[model samples]
Target: MAAGAPRIFVSHLSGVAVFDPAGDQVGRVRDLVVMLRVAQRPPRLLGLVVELATRRRIFLPMTRVTAIQSGQVITTGVLNVRRFEQRPTERLVFGELLDRRVVLTETGEEVTVLDLSVHQLPARREWEIDRVFVRKGRKGSAFRRAKGEALTVEWTAVSGFSLEEQGQGAENLLATFEQLRPADLANVLHHLSPKRRAEVAAALDDDRLADVLEELPEDDQIEILGKLKEERAADVLEAMDPDDAADLLGELPTDEQERLLSLMQPGDAADMRRLMSYEDRTAGGLMTTEPIVLRPDATVADALARVRNPDLSPALAAQVYVCRPPDETPTGKYLGTVHFQRLLREPPPSLVSSIVDSDLQPLDPDADLPAIAGFFATYDMVAAPVVDEAGSLLGAVTVDDVLDHMLPEDWRETEFHLAEEEVATDGS
Candidate 1:
C-alpha cells in the first residue's frame, strides 16, 4: 500500500492470494511472521508464510512484498522456495497470537485478542504490528461465543505480547538492540561471547545479519557466517550488498565458497563469481553490480524513483548511470551520468539523456586502488561509472568502497576496542 492507505487488520489478510508482477498467482499467505520487541514496543512484521500449490510453505520477506490490494498481495517475483522454519525470535501471527488473552495496561481489564493491525512505515519498506484488535468480558472460547465490548487500541496499550527488556536469551537481547545502527550492533556482537554471538546472529533475519556482517571485521564475518546453517548462509550472502558479499565469499575456502554459491540464486552467484575474478583492489573488485541503470529514454522521474529506493546507500543513490538498451549492468552502452542534483533540477518529464553529464570520464574495470581514489578526489565525485573497452557499463564505484579498501585491515578491531574503552571509562 502507498502512504495514504489505511492501517489494515490482520484478519483481512487471512489466506490472501499472493501474486507476482506478471499477475500469476504464486501462493496463498498462510500466516505472518513477526518479531516481538522489548517492553510494549510493537513487533516488526517480518514477512508472510506462504503455502504453494503443492502444499510447500516458504517464507516471503516484507522487502519482497510490493503491494497489498483488495484481495491479493503482490510481490517482486523473487522468491526463495525453502521451507519456512520459525526462528527463536519469530512468532506466527495466525498460530501463536490470535485467540490469546492479554491485558490493557491502564485499566487492567483482561481481553481476548481477535486480531492485530499492521502499518507500513512511510520512510522505508518496513512494516509493524501497530494496533491490537481485542474483545473484553469473558475470556477464551466463551468470549468468542458471546457478544462483548471490542475496540482497536494501539499495540502499546496491551502488555502481554511484548518480550521483557530484562529477559534472558539472545532473542531478548536482540529485541533490546533492535533500534541500533548496524555498526553499533556489530560492536555489540563483537563484545558478545562466541556462543552468544552465534545465537544473536542466528536470531537476526537475513537482511539484518547481512548489514551487521558488512560492518564486522573480516575474521568476525567469517566466524559468524561459518556458524550459520549452509542454506541460511547462502540466503544471508544473497541479502548482502554484492561487493561485500563477494569480498566475504573470496575469503572462504574454495570448496565452501562453491557450496554456498550453489545454494544462492543463480543471478547473485554469477555476480559473486564475476566480482571474484577481479583483483581485490581494482575498480571491478570494489564496484557493485547492482548500480541503478536507466536507458537513455528513461525520464528524470524514473531516475528519481529508483534513487528513492531505501535499500541503496547514499553513495549509490548519489547519481544514476544512463545507458543504452538493456538497462541491467553491464548495460548496452556507457551513455553518461545524471547526478541526483541534476535530476532534481530538471522537469520530471525530461529525458535523462538530454541532461546527461557526458564530460566526466568513467573508470576502467581494471583501474587500480590509487587510481580509483585519485579519480574520486580529482572529480570530487562520490561515485563514478565503470565502463569496459567495449563501452558497456560494468558497474559504478563509490567512494565508500575506496575508503574501505584504503583503510587498515585491522580498523574494525581498533574501532571495537575504542568503543569498549569508552564504555569502560563511562562505567568507571
Candidate 2:
C-alpha cells in the first residue's frame, strides 16, 4: 500500500452518502465507473453513479470529488444532472467486477473477487484499483476456510476472468447483480447489449427474473421474453404479477403471446387471458388476479399468514379480500375487503367477515382509467377490487399499475433530469 494513499475498499463505498462542500447531501454512491486499459494495468477511476432523492441516477466525475472517508463522500459542489449513461469503454465496479472469479497467477487457484481496494496515486490527482480481496475456492467450495481468512492480494497477482471464459455463460455475473435491488438490476440489464442481457436473464431464477422484468421497459421485456425458451418464459410470466404479465403479453405478437400462454398453468393462463380481453386502459386490464384473498369464514390468522408471504407485492399484501365459497375468482361472489390495519386490530381467531369493509363499492371491470383513478383518490386506497356484472370477485387493481398506465407512452425513455444543464465535456 502507498503511504498516506487514502485507500478505501469498494464495498464500503458502495452506499456512502455523497455531500456538497456545504454539507447538504447530493446523493448516495450507487456504483463506481472505471475504464480498463492494458490487461495487467489497474483500471482508471472515471466517476461515481449517484442516485438522487428522486430515484434518478446521474454521474459525478471523480475530479469533482473532494474527499472520501467514513460514512460520506464530499464533492466540490459542482455536478452535471443529466442521467448517467455508461459509455462503451466504461465498466461498473459493483455491477461488473465485484463477486467475479479471478485466477491467482502464482497458485493457479480460482477465487471470488469479494471486494477491491482503490488508492490515490502518489502526488497525482489520479486514483486506480490497487488491490483485490479474494475468497479462495472453486464454485461449490466457496465456504471453505482459506487458512482462516481470505487473501488481500495486489491487483496484478490475479488475472480477471470474463463471462465468456466461465463456461456457465453469465452465471457468475448474476451473483453481483443479485445484490442490487430489482430496479437497480433492471437499470444494469437495460444498459447491457442484447446478447449480454439475454445471458444474464438466462442465469436468473424465475422469481428474480420476474421482478427484474416488471421493472424493465416494454421493449426490453418483449426482447428478453423472446430470448427465453417458451416453457421457461411461461414460467417467468407465471411468477410475475398477472397485470404486468398481461401488459407485456399485449405488447407481443398475438401468436407469440398465445404460444407462451399455452405453456403456463391452466389457472394462471385463464387469469391472463381474462385480463387480456379487456381494454388496456380499463380496470380489468390493470388488475392483478392474485391479490390476497380468503373465504368469508376464514380467521384473521389465515389472512395474516397470507400477507406474510414475501412474494406478495406490498399493495396486495396490505389487504385481503373476503369472498364466499367456491373461494376461487370468477366463481366466488364479491363480498368485501379487510385492510391489514383492521385485521391487526381484531383478535386473531375472529372471522375475517367480522372486519370486512362491505360498504366499499368495487369497481366494474369495464370502468375507465379516469374512473379507477378517481376511486383510488376518493377512497385513499392502495388497491381496489374489480368485479363483473354478477358481482364476482375478479381481481384487484394496484395503485402502481394505474400510475404506470397513466404515464406517457414514452415515459420510460425520458431522462431523469435533475436540473436544466448541458452535458459535461469531461470524463468520456
Candidate 3:
C-alpha cells in the first residue's frame, strides 16, 4: 500500500491480497485470528499467513505490515520467505511491561499509561476493549483517577511506526524514538524521570538511542549512562560526540570509566582519549570531533554535492566548517564556516567564500561553562566555532548543549519563557 493508502479494520479484514513492494503477490488473509485468553486479553493477530498453491505457508508478522489498502495489504520493502520461519513469537509481556507505566498519548497529551480497568459496558458486561485511565494530582489533596479516556485513533491515522511500536502495544497510541525529531526527543527526555528515561533508552535501538544521547545535557547524559547496562552504555558513549563522551566518562568513577572505554571500539576510544586531554571547561574540550571540514578551494558546488549523500549523520549541525583540507599541516588554516541554510540558499556553482562569514567568533578549548554560555549570549549564535590557540577550526558547540549546562533546574522556566515569547510574537 502507498503511504496514504486507505485502512480497513481487522474485524473487516476478509481475503485481502498481500503484496510486497515489488508487486509480487505473496499471500492472502486466511482468517482473522484473535487470541482471546482464558482470562487475559486475546492476542492481536499473531500475524497473517498466506497459503500458496504449493501448500507452503508464508507468514507476515503484524509489525512488518505497512498498510491496508482498498483490496490489498502491503508489506514493507521486500519479502523474504525465510522471514516467516524466523518470525518472532508474540512477545510474552508478563513480567515487567504489562501494567507498567508507559507514555500514553491520550487527549492529544502524553499522560502515563496505567493498568486496565474492568468497566462493565452500559448495555452488556461481556464485551470490552481495555479501559485506559490517567492518574491526576498529588496524593491526598486531589489525587484522582480519570477513566474512560483513551486515544481512539483510526488505524489510518498512523503515518509510520518504529521497531518499538509492538512493545508499546499495537493498539496503544505511541511512537518510536526514531520516528520523533531530535528536538522532540530532547523534550521527551527532559520531561521523563531517571528511571523512565532508562526504560525509554532500553526500548530504542543503538543508533537511534545514540542520536538521542548526543543531544542530551551532560548531567542528564551522565545520569542516563549510570542506569544503562554496560554494553548499552558503551555503545551509546562510543557513538556520541567525543567531547560529550569525555565529559560523561569524567563524571563516572575511574574504574567504571575505564571499563566502558575498554568496551568501546579502539578508534572511538582513542578519539575520546584525545578529547579528554583538554580540560572540560576549554574549547578543545567542548568541540565535537565530527565537523564537516572542507578545503578553502572547495566550491559551494562540491559542498552541496557532499551534503546530498543520504549517509550523513542526523546529528549534523546547521553550520558547515569551511577550512583548509584535512591534508594540510594544521586544520586551523583560518577559513570560516557557512551556515547550512545560507549555503542552501545559493546556487551550487557559487564560491564558498562569497557565502562564508569571516567575522566568525570562536571559543578557546579551555573555556569554562560560564565562559561558553557568555559566548553564546554575546554573539547570539546558535553554534559557536571551537578553535586551538593557533585559530584553527576544531569543532563547534551548539547552543542547546550550552543551555543544558547553564540551566540545571527542571527546564520549566525556559519552557515557560519560550511559550510566552511565542504567544507575544504571534499576537504581534
Candidate 4:
C-alpha cells in the first residue's frame, strides 16, 4: 500500500481473495506474519500466509503486495510458492494475537485483543501493526458471555505483545536497531557475537540483508552468507548489486561459486560470470553492469524519469549513457553521455543525443585502479562509462568503487561507536 491508503484491520483481511497482476485468483489469505519488537513499538507486518487452490500455504512478502482492498489483495505475480515456516521472531496474527489479554498503558484495565490495524509507513513499503481494538470486559464462555466496553487504541498503548520472555533476544536487538541505515546496521552486526550476528542476519528480510551484506567487510559477509540455507543464500545474492555479488562470489571456492550461480536466474549468472572473468582491480570488475543506458533518440524527459528512480544510487543516477539498439550491458555501439544537469537544462522533449558529451574518452575494460582513479580526479566525475574495443558500453565505474579499492584493507576497523560515545561525553 502507498502513503495515503486506508489502514486495514486484520479481521477484515482473513479469508480475503488474492489475485495476481493478470487478475487470476491465486489463493486466499490464511494469516499474517509479523515481528514483535522489544518495547511498545508496533510490530512490523512482514507478509501474509496464503493457501493456494491445492491447499498449500505459502508466505507472500509484503514487498510483493501492490494493494489491499475491501475483499481482495493484489500481488506482483511473483509468489515464492515455498511452504511458509514461522521464523523464531515471527508471529501469526489470527492464530495468536486475536482474543489475547493485555493491559492498556494509559489505564490499569486489562483488555482482550479483538483485532489489530496495520498500515504502510509513509513513502515506504514497510507496513506495521499500528492500532489495537479491544474489549474491556472479561472473556465470555461458550454459551454465557458478559457484555464489555470496546475501543481502539494505538499499538504503543499496549505492552504484553512485546518482549515479555527473553530480555535480550535477536528480536529485541533487531527492533532496537531496525531504523539504522544498512552501513550502520552492518557495523552493529560486526560488533556482535558471531552467534547473535548470524541470528540477526537470518531474521532480516532478503532485500534488507542483501543491502547490509554489501556494506559489510568481506569476512563478515562470508560468515553470514555461510550461515544461511543455500537456497536463501542464492536469493540474497540475486537481490544484491551485480558487481558486489560478483565480488562476494569471487571470494568463494570455484565449485561453491558455481553452485550458487547455478541457482540464480540465467541472465544474472551470466553477468556474474562476465564480471568475475576480469581482474579484481580492473574497470570491468569495479564497474556495475546495470548502469542507466538509453538510446540516442530518447528524450530528456525519459532520461529524467529513469533518474528519478528511488532505487538508483546517487553516483549511478548522476548521468546516463546513450547507446545504440541494445540497452543492457555490452550494449550496441556507445553513442555518448548526457549528465543529469545537462538533461535538466534542455527541454523535456529534446533528444538526449543532441546534447551528448562525446568528447571525454571512455575507460577501457582493462583500465587498472590507478588509471580509473586518475580519470575521476582529472574530470571531477562521479562516474564514467567503460567500453570495449568494439565500442560497446561494458559498464560504468563510480567514484565510490575506486575509493573502496584505494582505502587501506583495515579501514573497517575504525570504531564508529567510540566517536559517538566521545560526543556524548562532551555533551554531558
Instruction: Give the Cα lDDT of each candidate.
Output: 0.92, 0.81, 0.57, 0.89
- In the range 1-428, model 1's lDDT, one tens digit per residue, is 77657898889899999999999999999999999988788899999999999899999999898899888999989999989999999999999999889999999999989989998987667899999989998875544484689998999998888887675788899888888999999999998999999999999999999999999999999999999999999999999999999999999999999999999999899999999999989999999999999988899999999998788999999999988979878789888999999989999999999999999889999999999999998989999999999999988898988998999999989999999999999999
Best by TM-score: 1
Judged by lDDT, which candidate is best? 1
Determine the backbone clash count of candidate 4. Answer: 0
Q: What would the TM-scores of all predictions be?
A: 0.96, 0.60, 0.50, 0.83
Candidate order by decreasing TM-score: 1, 4, 2, 3
Structure candidate 1, residue pairs in collision: none
Steric collisions counted per model: 0, 0, 12, 0
Candidate 1, superposed: residue stretches over 4 Å from native: 140-144
- What are the per-residue Cα lDDT tens digits for candidate 3 across 107-224? 3333333332221123221212234333432222236544544443321222111133333432221243334655567657766777667666665534456667766665767777
RMSD of each: 1.6, 16.8, 15.5, 3.7
Off by over 4 Å in 3: 1-200, 214-229, 305-316, 327-332, 341-346, 351-355, 369-371, 409-428
If both were scored by TM-score, which would come out higher, candidate 1 or candidate 3? 1
lDDT of 4 at 315: 98
lDDT of 4 by residue, 244-301 (tens): 9999999999999989988787788899999999999899999999899999889999
Error of 3 at 425 (Å): 25
